[model samples]
Target: MNPAQSTQPTQSTQEKQYFDLHTTGIGYLNRIREVSPKKGNPFLACNIAALSGAADDVVYTRFDCRVSGKEAEALVRQYEDAVKQDQKVLISFKIGDLWADTFTYTKGDKTGQTGVSLKARLLFISWIKVNGQLVYKAEKAERPQLEQDPSGQASQGGQDDQAEATSSEDSPAPAAEASSSPKEAPRQSAQIALPETVQLSKDAPDFQERKAALKQQGYRFDGQAKVWRLPTDAAKSAIEAQHQANAQDWARSAQATA
Candidate 1:
């Protein structure tokens, strides 16, 4: 036997592991432009005002995203005219690899103050509604398929039921709920629901780190429900993988102590 060769560590062929955090929601698209950087090729960029919280008290989280996918770039370009004309270009968006970029505000009342902007790559546009009119919807083939859990329910970190319950809550309220005065109903509803969500547990290992990561990725906390929520679209697999890894680490730690 070659003792020296046997002493060397074996190189396993396992694929490199990477963590992906994606943000999915309905948002108003804005600031569509082509960015030319000195070091890299020019790319399309845009801003999205993502809606969150209750229908009555919706909050907006702005994402300065680089349009990454070809389909997304094309879609954003198509709506440039509408956006330039000041029409509301609302879309169901999927943003990937979200992070926060801090900068000193150079103008406005908060000049010289540090401001944090959310940045990401715009990966997909599931659908678009311009001025309350449906303009585009991705075909079924283009949509991602959600994995089914052992319970036969679409698994989103056990938040499928919670998502369904609160999905409509994130959208802008209808005319009736928006005003005290009774308003005639439109022929068709214009309300758009938020994306399906996955909940983060408080008991998870490295809970704060996970929470901070999710916050950077544009996930919101449902104070009323006492859970952190993230969209369950393209992020489902990533979310499940993260929690599974957390579980394994916790089990190994417990075993080591035992």
Candidate 2:
């Protein structure tokens, strides 16, 4: 080897981490929206109020998510139904972006606190329990190979396509023909499964904490159902106002990134 080759530094390699998110919590649905910030690609966003700490000394954590996939859609639908029917349910969610920020409340008192947020771009909700009973269960969302590659080297310029073409040459039929075949064609929605309910353990620790925190927030515990209740009250209006504000903020962020 040349002397210069030995002396030269090896460039640092950065690889994307896969399957890094696994979060499970119980929180109140702050806000939910089915929006297409970009054309054709739609996503669901939810601003959730997660509970923290003991009942006597509770901290209100902000758990928010912006995600695409069928599970997200189902979550949005469930949130809507809960809102419409005036139901309070406990949930268990996982695989999302978890973060914290210290910011002013902006609504009233102009308070500042270290609040956490969870963005579930790719995630699974293990279960949802209502009234200490299992209502729904869901599995983790299946990851798409080309959608998010850990190497960050695929799909940008068709690198993966080139390799796939070579390896799948003997896959019984050409990819183009296979895609073009009417019966074998795939729908855009097939990328993920439809949203489903969660089946959480009634004894989950977080469920109790979530119930207590929600109760502190004026949510009543229904003696009939034995579940914490969420009211279609002032908070919904307040959250919608925040939604509009977020749209404005999103526009600014998009502009900055662009």
Candidate 3:
């Protein structure tokens, strides 16, 4: 391996693990090379090859299958409908999982040929996660070897193209808000009454903490303008409660206070 070369994927330090079958170590995939005469004369033939993770164990009754034309489009519609209606559904493939990720295969008389022209049935079961959390897990049966089409293609049935937003956890979270105290500017709002010399200025210690405390109590700090505004009745009540508590404690005898 080149010293600088990386074995990990570019976006994350977390490694992706594949299926590991004992002995042969076939990984997580098994292939079906031949198509069988089925009960239905469909445009496409799909098979259910393997199930992975916790989701694959259950049997589903309302699965859909499509022939020759486009398995992904038809399957996605079925999957979406089932999910929306809260039904169980599985996708089958016209070819194996490996073939779905590849563009071309040379099988039988079509050796060395590109694209899917054969009447082969394949299946793949897959799970997908966003930022290490499962978003959708599914199975697909499709012929992935087709000429690039004018319409963009969805991934093979169970294959998921997780959005990058979902992978945010795998990457460093946005740098935490700067810890240095935020500078306070002179108050500019005419509505706020303040003494001329008591003008709020920048360089206050723990400004962020104070602001955060106020914010937690439903206050909004216009730091640039050096004004704090109450956002809700809760905030007004909280501020009044603090003052009342202080006054009540002050009323206690000096000896008792001391």
lDDT of each: 0.62, 0.43, 0.30
**Which pairs clash inside model 1?**
none
Candidate with more favorable, higher lDDT: 1 or 3: 1
Give the number of the best model, judged by TM-score. 1
Write down the worst ten-residue block by lDDT for model 2.
Answer: 188-197
Write the number of the candidate with greater lDDT, choosing between 1 and 2. Answer: 1
In model 2, which runs have C-alpha deviations exceeding 4 angstroms?
1-19, 36-40, 55-58, 100-122, 139-258
lDDT of 2 by residue, 1-258 (tens): 876566555566555565544454454444566665432345567655444444433334455576544774676576566643444444554435343211235463324321212334435554555433457655323322335468665531243234223321112111121223333222111111111212223564234533443443445556676654446663353344445444554465456556
> Which model, 2 or 3, shows the larger TM-score?
2
- How much does candidate 3 score in TM-score? 0.16
Q: Residues 1-258, candidate 3, lDDT per residue (tens digit)?
A: 899997777766667765421110001111112234333222333322222222312211111122233434344434443333422232222332121101123475334432211112223323422223544444333223333347876443212333222222222111111122122111111111111111122453323433443444444556576665555565344444444443443354233535
Positional deviation of 119 in candidate 3, in angstroms? 79
Best by lDDT: 1
In angstroms, give how far residue 136 of model 2 lies from its true place: 0.8
Ranking by lDDT: 1, 2, 3
